[model samples]
Target: MKTQNLTVKAVSRGLTLALSTMCIAITSACANFSGIHDDRQMSTPEHYTSSQSLPAERGHWPSADWADQFGDSQLSALIAEALGGSPTLEQARARVAAAEAFSETATAKTLPHIDADNALTRTQYSANALVPPPYAGSWQTENRGLLSASFDLDLWGKNREALKASVSQTEAARADAEMVRLTLTEAIARTYNRLALQFVLHDMAEREVRNREAINAIESRRVASGLDTEVQHKLAQTRLSASKSKLVGLDGSIRATRYQLASLMGEGPDRGLSIARPALGMGNDIRLPDNLPADLVSRRPDIVAARWRVVSLAHEVKVAKAEFYPDINLSAAVGLDVLGLGRLLTAASRTASMGAAIHLPIFDAGALRAQLKGRYAEYDGAVARYNQTLLTALGQVATQIAELRTTDVQLNDARDAQNATRQANHLASLQFQTGIANQLTVLDADLNTLAAEASVADLEMRRRDRQIQLAAALGGGFVDASVAHPRNTPAAVAAR
Candidate 1:
C-alpha cells in the first residue's frame, strides 16, 4: 500500500510537469504570434513614385465621352456595342466573381462551425455461468443525438492573413477586368479608324479610275482627229487599267476591314455591317496639354493590378512565415449514452467532454524551412515584376507623348503639301485648257495633287489613331475622384 501510494504521487507529479511544459510551449507560441506586423502597414510599399507626370486636365481629349472626341456617332456606337457584348470582358468579370467567392470562404473560417449528428443502435445479450445477470436474456436499444460546435482561436493570425490575401486577389481580378475593358475599347476604336481610312482610300481609288477613263476618252478623240500619237493613247489606256486594278484592290481591303470589325463586335464573319465614311473636315483646334501630372500611373488599371499583386505576395509571405508557429485548435461535444432510446436525453444518461489540440513542428528534415525560402523567393520575384510593370507603363506613356508631338508636326506639313499641290494642279489645268501646257504636264500635276491628297488623308487618320492611343494610355477615360475603390454600378452588378 505504501508503494502504491508512492507510485500514485509520482504519476501526479509527472502529469503536473507535462502540463507545465505544455503551458510553456503555448506561451512561447503566443509570444511569437504577437510580434507579427499588421498586414496594412507591411503590405503597402515603402515608397511609390510615379516615373512621369499625370495627364493634364486641360488635355486635347475631353474627360467626358472619350469616344465622341472623334465626332463620329457610329464609331461611338460600335465601341459601346463591343464593350457590352465582348466575351473576353465577360470572362474577366466571371473571374472577379470567383475571387470574391473565395474571399468569402476565407472569411467564413473565422466563425464557429456547428454540426448535428444522431445515432441509433440495437444489441442482444446472453447470460454466462461465470457472470451474474439481472435477466436471462435481454435486448437493448441505444440512441444518441448531439449538437457540436468548434472554433479555432486564430492566435497565429493565419486565417486573417489568408483572408487578406484573398481580398487582395479579388481586387487584382477587378483591375484585370477593367484592363480588359480598356483594351477592348482601344481595339474597337483602332478598327473603326482603319475602316474609315480604308473607305476614304476606296473613294480616292474610284475617283482616280474615273479620271483615268475620262483621259482615255480624250486621248482616243485626239488620236481619231490625228492630233495624238498611238503611244499617247496606249499610255492613257495603261493608266486607266492600273487605276481600275487599284480600285479593285481597295474594294477588297474595305471588305476585309468591315469583316474584321464585325468579328470584333461579336458577330459572324460574313455579317453585313456597313461602316459609313467619316466626314472629311480639317481642323487643328484641339489643344494638347504641355505638361502632364504625376499621379496618372496609379489610375491605370494594369498598374493598379500590379500593385495589388505585390500586396497579395506580401500576404503570402506572412502566411508562409506562419508555418513556423504551432497551430491551435479547440473542439467540444455533448451527448448521451443509454440502454433505451427514451432515456437518451435525461440528466442521468447525459455526458459531455471538451478538448484542445496543438500541432507543433519540431523536425521536418528542413522541408518547412525550404518551403519558406521558396515563398520568400516568390515574394522577391513579385516585387521585381511589380517594378517592371511600372517601368513599362512609364515607357508607354513617354512613347505616346513623343509620337503625338511628332505626328502633330507631320500633319501640319502634310496639309501644307496638299494645299500647294492643289494650287499647282489648278494652274496646270488652266494652262492645258488654253494650249499653254501639254497633256503630259496636266497629267503629272493631277497625279501629284492626287498623291498629296492621299498623303493628307492618311496623315489625318494616323493623327486620330494616335489621339485614341494617347487616350487609352491615359487610363481609358479619366479617373473619377469619388471612386476610391473599384465600383460596379447597380446595372453592371445586376448584369453580372
Candidate 2:
C-alpha cells in the first residue's frame, strides 16, 4: 500500500512540473509577441516625393495591355513569347512550389502522426530462463501487429507560430515569381524597341550611301567636263566612302542587338536573324488617371515580396522564443501478440501500451535566444529593403515623367528642323534642274534632311523607351491573388 501511494505521488509531481513549465513557456512567448516591428505605423505619402502629379492612367494603375500602347503587334507577340519561354520565370515558379511544400510540412507538424508495424519471430527458450517449464526448452513462434500515434501538445503555440512563418514565406515566394514575370516582359519590350531602332538606323545609313553615290556621279561628270577641280572630286569620293562605312557599322550593331533579343527569348542566337523588322511610332496616347491611389507602391512586386519576408521573419522570431518552453508529446500502441500464429488475433492474446514525454531545454547555452535575436535582425533588414524598393519605384516613375516631358520638347525641335531641311532640299532640287545651283548643293540639302529625320527617329525611340520604363515602374498592372492561409492575404503596405 505504501509503494502504491509513492508511485501516485511521483506521477502527480511530474504532471505539476510539466504544467508549470508550460505556463512559463506561454508567458515568455506572450512577452516576446510585441517585439516584431510593425511597418504599418509609418505614414504613406499621397504622391511621389519627386513629383506633384503622376502620369495619367486610363482603366487601371498600369493598363494590362501596356505593351500594346506602342502599337507594335510584333513587339507584343514577342513579349508574350518570352514570358512563356523564359527560364527565369520557370525558376521563380519552382521556388514558389518549394515554399508551398515547406508550408504544408510545417502545418503537418501541428497535427498527430500515426504509424503501423507488423512482425513475426521464432525463438528457443533456455531452460534457466524466466518462462513456464513446458516452454523453457522448446522453440516458440509469435505473430504481432501494432498501430501507434503521437502528437506534440503545442502548449506554447510553437507549432502554430512555425506554421505562420512558413505561410508567409510561401506568399513571399509567389510575389517573387510575379516580380520575375514583370521583369521578363519589360526586358522583351525594351529589346524589341532597340532592335527596331537598329533596323531604322540601318535603313537610314543605306539611303545616305545611295545619295552620296549619286553626288559622286555628278562630281565625276563635272570633273570630266573640266568644270570641277580634282580636289572637289576627291572630296565627293571621300564622302561616299564614309557613308558606306557607316552602313557597315550599322549592320554590325543590328546583328548584335538581334542576338541579345534571341537570348532573352530563350532561343538560339541565329533565330534572331529571322525576326522581321517591327513598326513602332512614338506618341503619348496613354495617360494616367488624375487620381493616383495611396497604395500604388504596394503593387510593386519587390515591395510586396519584401513585406512578406518581414512578416515571415516576425513569426520566426516568435517560433524561436517559443522554444524557451518544454516540448510535450503523447503516444500509444495496441497490438495482438501470441506464442502461436493461430491465436494472434484472439482478445486474450492482446497487448497494449501508452506513454507521454516531456523535454525542457535545461542547458542549451543561450542558443534559442541567439536564434530569436537573429530572426529579429532579419526582420529589420527586410523592412529596410522594402522601404528602399518603394523609394526606387517612386524615383523611377518621377524620372520617367520628367524625361517624357523633356523628350516632347526635343521632339518638337527635331520636327521643326526636319521640316526646314525638307523645304531646303526641294528648293535645291528645282535650282539644279534649271541649272541655277550645282548638283553638290542639292546633295548637301539631301544629307541635311536625312540627318534631321534620323534625329527625330532617335528621339521618338527614347520616348517609347521612357513609356515602357514608366509602366514597369508602376508594377505592370499585376494583381496579387489571395492566398489560402492563416492571414488570407498580406497587409496592404507590403502588397496590393
Candidate 3:
C-alpha cells in the first residue's frame, strides 16, 4: 500500500513538471490583438445639464402608481387589465426567460464537468488471428466503463468574462420588460382620455342640433310674417343640416375611440361597447426629479437596458481578447477495461489516466485579430446606443415639460372663453323674456355657448393627456436595483 501511494505521488509530480515546462515554452507564442484601436465613446449626464429648458429646482420622481394621480378609478382599472392580458408584455417576459437561460448556460461552462460512459461488444476470434492460447477460436464479450472529468484552466478569464456578459444581458432584458409595461400603461391612459374628449364633444353636438332647430323655427316665423327673406330662412335650414352632420361625425369618432380603447385592453370592439365615458382629471403640474440628467440614466428602462448592453459587450470584448491567448485544459478518466464480461468489474480490469493539454494557434491567418476587432466594434456600437438612449430620454422629458407648460396657459384661456359665452347666453335669455331680444338671438347665443363649452372640455382632456405623456417620458417610475452599484460602466470597461 505504501509503495502504491508513492507511485501515485510520483506520477502527479511528473505531470506537474511536464505541464509547467510546456506552459513556459509556449506562453510567448500567443497571437496579438492589441494594435487595434477604436474611437467610440459614451456621453455623460453633463451633456444634458447645459440645456436651459429643464427645470432648475428640486422636485419629485413619479411613483409606481403614478396613474392613480389622475384620480379616475376607471382609468386605473383599464391600465391593470391591459398589463395582465397584453400580448406585448407577454412577449417581453418571454425574452427575459431566454436571456436567463443563456446566462445559466454561460455559468455552467465555467465549472468542472463529469460524465459516465460505457460500451460492450461481442466477437468471435479466428484460429489464424493474433490471439494465441487454448481459446484462440472461442467467442468473447468485451466491456468497458468510464467516468471522465474535464476542466478548462481559464487562466485568462475567458469563461469568467462570458458569464458576466450573460448576467448583464439578463439584467438588460429585465429592464426591457419594465419599459414595455410603462409603454402599455401610458397607451391605455391616453386612449381613455380620447374617449372622454369624444364623449364631451358628442354631447355638445347634440346641444348644438337642438339650438339650431329652435333657430329654424324662429326663422320660419319671421319669413311668414314678411319680416325676413326666403334666403335667410333657407340659410337657417342649411345651418341646421350642418349641425346634424357635425353630430354624426362626432358619434362616429366616439365609436372608433372606444374600439381603440378595447384593443389596447387586449379585447374586442364588444368590450368597448361596455366601457363608460372616462372621468379622468388632470393631475398636479409636472415636476422634475430632484436630480435631473445625471439620475435620469437609471430611472428610464430603455437607457438602463442600453447601458447594460454596453456593459455586456464590454465584457465580450475582454472574452474575445482572451481568445487570442492559449487555452489549457485538464482531463482525467477512471474506468474498467476487460476482454470478457466476467472480469469487467474485477481489479485486474481497473485503469486510471490523467493529463493536461495546451492549445496555441501557430498560423490562424489573422482570424483571432479579426474576431477581436469585431468584438471591439460591437462594444463601440453598444456605447453609441447607450448614449443615444440617454440623450433621447432626457430630451423627451424636456419636451413634455415644455408642452405641459403651454397646455396650462391654453387650458386657462379655454375656460375664460367658456365663462364669457355663458354670461352672454344668460343675458340674451333675459332680454328675450323681457321682449327686448328675439328668440333667434337667444338661440344663437345658446349655440355659441355650447361650442365654447366643448372647446374647454377638449382643452381639459388635452392637459390630462399631456400629463400622462410626461409621466411616461419620466420613465414611469422604473427603478433598477443594479444601477445603485454597477460593477462596470461602458467607459471603464472600454479602457481595459
* Candidate with better lDDT, 1 vs 3: 3
| lDDT by residue for model 2 (1-496), tens | 6996697668756865766666675654432333434343222444235336564456356766788877888888878888888888889999999999999999999999989998889999999979878999999998889888888888778899789889889988988998998888888888788888878888889989999999889889999999989988899999899999999988998888888888888889998898788888673454555444345546778767876787777677667767777777877787888887788777898777766787667656667666767776776677677667767777777778788889989989999999999999999999999999987899899999999999998998888888888788878887654421335323531221
Superposing all C-alpha atoms, what RMSD in Å does each candidate have to the true structure?
A: 8.2, 5.1, 2.3
Model 1 score (lDDT): 0.70
Model 1 alpha-carbon drift over 4 Å, by segment: 1-64, 121-141, 219-235, 270-274, 279-293, 336-339, 438-443, 478-496
CA deviation > 4 Å runs, candidate 3: 1-30, 126-137, 484-486
Each prediction's TM-score against the native? 0.80, 0.86, 0.93
- Among these predictions, the greatest TM-score belongs to 3
Sort by lDDT, best first: what order? Answer: 3, 2, 1
lDDT string for model 3 (1-496, tens) is 7998798778866876777577657756756775786767678888656458776566687887898987889888888888999889999999999999999999998999999999988878888989887658988888989999999878779999999999999999999999999999998888888888888888888888998888888889999999999999999999999999999998888888888888888898898888888787778767676667777777899988998898898889889888877787888899999988777878889988887787777668999889988988888788888888888888888888888888889878988998999999999999999999988889889888997888788788888887888888888888776664644766666556
Q: Per-residue lDDT of 1-496 in model 1, one digit per residue for the tens?
A: 6996697567655644564477556655342323333222212221443323334436553353677767788877877887788788889999999999999999999788888888887866677543246533666776877778787767667788788778888988998898888888888778778777888888788878877887898889999999999999999999899999998988888788888777777777665256666553332344445333334545577767766776676776677677767666666677777878777767988766665566676656767667666765665676577666666666676677677678889988988999999899999999999999977677778778888888988888887777777777767764533223333211111111
Candidate 1 to truth, TM: 0.80
Shift in Å, residue 308, candidate 3: 0.3
In model 3, pairs of residues that clash are: none
Question: Model 3 residue 335 lDDT?
Answer: 99
User: What are the lDDT figures for the candidates, one per model?
Assistant: 0.70, 0.77, 0.85
Show how many residue pairs clash in every candidate, following the order shown: 3, 6, 0
